[model samples]
Target: MTDSGIPVVFIHGLWLHASSWAPWLELFRENGYQPLAPGWPGIPDTVELARADPESIADKGIDDVTRHYAAVIDTLPRKPIIIGHSFGGMIAEKLLGENEGVAAIAIDAAQIKGVLPVPLSSLRATLPVFKNPANRHRAVSLTAEEFRYSFGNAVSPEESDELHRQWTIPAPGKPLFEAATANFSPHSPAAVHTENEERGPLLLIMGGQDHTVPEVITKSTLKQYRGSSAVTDLVEFPDRGHSLTVDSGWRAVADACLDWLRKQNL
Candidate 1:
């Protein structure tokens, strides 16, 4: 495939290893884009190592992960198109706001500072981290049952278990803690530059059945960018859950993204 000279950066959210983006990277490359999926700071290169030494990623917060990706962008040949999921999605928005990317796609991103709706399911989904305040400074691993609830709820139990076995890893709790308290904090790392009118285009993708980040959260996120004249769009997958990006139907989601990028001429 001839190189398009366009870079696509994939950012994974909590509990999923960066390698989970393998399929997307291959697909994007075949379509002429240079795609890279980098692990979060302190993250091991592989899922096994990341699971074995969760402590290496403990205590890392949103700002830490954001800064890490920002540094990664600095090394790229050109400003990449940032595509992120969960917390990674929020980080992508922050990066785009700072003029780090040519555009961004935030898929089921975590809530930022201005979002106020906290759905009960969202609370239950994150109960693993919130149940113990100490988790804020530790790395927390989810059991298969918990993963089923949080990330695989909309998928078949069998497929859910398989996804858990393949990609689930311990994730830092600090980012969740920071997001939970963002609205109350004057200096929350969860804050994004939604007011930046000069930033590049942004697309917010939501999994309608997502227990972790419901559609309401994504809609609220869109509202935050209303004051800015920058291009911001929203798309929802009503039948999908948090696992949509890695599940069987992921190709559809990825195709939608590619279609959108083409529309933007990027």
Candidate 2:
């Protein structure tokens, strides 16, 4: 943000802790950037703690979650560049809108929910949890099989299974409910109130094979923000899925952002 040091932050999606961003944080550090990855409210910092009890904080909402990260960003030495995946991507976009210094990259992001283009894949990906109204106050864990279909579709079965074992934690259902039931109103929980021109160089990346946040969502979001003067770029990776940031070929995506950073002279 100040151009005084490396500026990069990684935000993980639902069912994942900040540690999931560790791989990318290391990559960014190697490329001469400072990295910050923080977790949501009441979320344990370690995977062991998260696995030990998934129901501890199953009712957290988007605003509460956003405020937690807002506090984290407040402590930063400067307005760090942000990179987020899935739900985290949504929060990053909100942060970009709220803070003038935020530069952002959203990967496989799901915008508020009522953007008029719900691809069948996107619906199917979220169906496991959203099919029931009771999920709102509960925590949802991905079955190995379900995780494979929604997230690991980009990789091998074995690799996907292992990543599933290592990364996912139970996620609060309230955020999804709010996103799904965003009320089609300008004043809503899912409303990010973003100004495309106010955001710094931003990028939105999508997975070609992703079911959770399909390519159409990225395209539509770009179209909505096309009027902004800020640089906005959309990129799609062949066969990638919602778990693009955590999978084996994640480096390519991260490197792409790094290349974009060079182009922006950030």
Best by TM-score: 1
Q: Which ten residues in a row have the lowest lDDT in candidate 2?
A: 1-10
lDDT of 2 by residue, 1-266 (tens): 35556667677888777798888888888888888787778888898898788787588888887888888777778888888899888887777877634588889877763466878887777777898888898888888898988898888999999998898898888988888777565566677655556667778898899978888888877776656677778888977888888888988998998888888787
Residue lDDT tens for model 1, 35-105: 99999999999999999999999999999999999999888888999999999999999999999999999
List candidate 1 stretches off by more than 4 Å: 1-4
Model 2: colliding residue pairs: none
Report the number of clashing residue pairs per model.
Answer: 0, 0
What local distance difference test score does each model get?
Answer: 0.95, 0.80
Worst 10 residues of 1 by lDDT: 1-10
Residue 206: error of model 1 in Å? 0.5
lDDT (Cα) of model 1: 0.95
Best by lDDT: 1
Clashes of 1: 0
Give the per-residue Cα lDDT of candidate 2 at 138.
Answer: 82
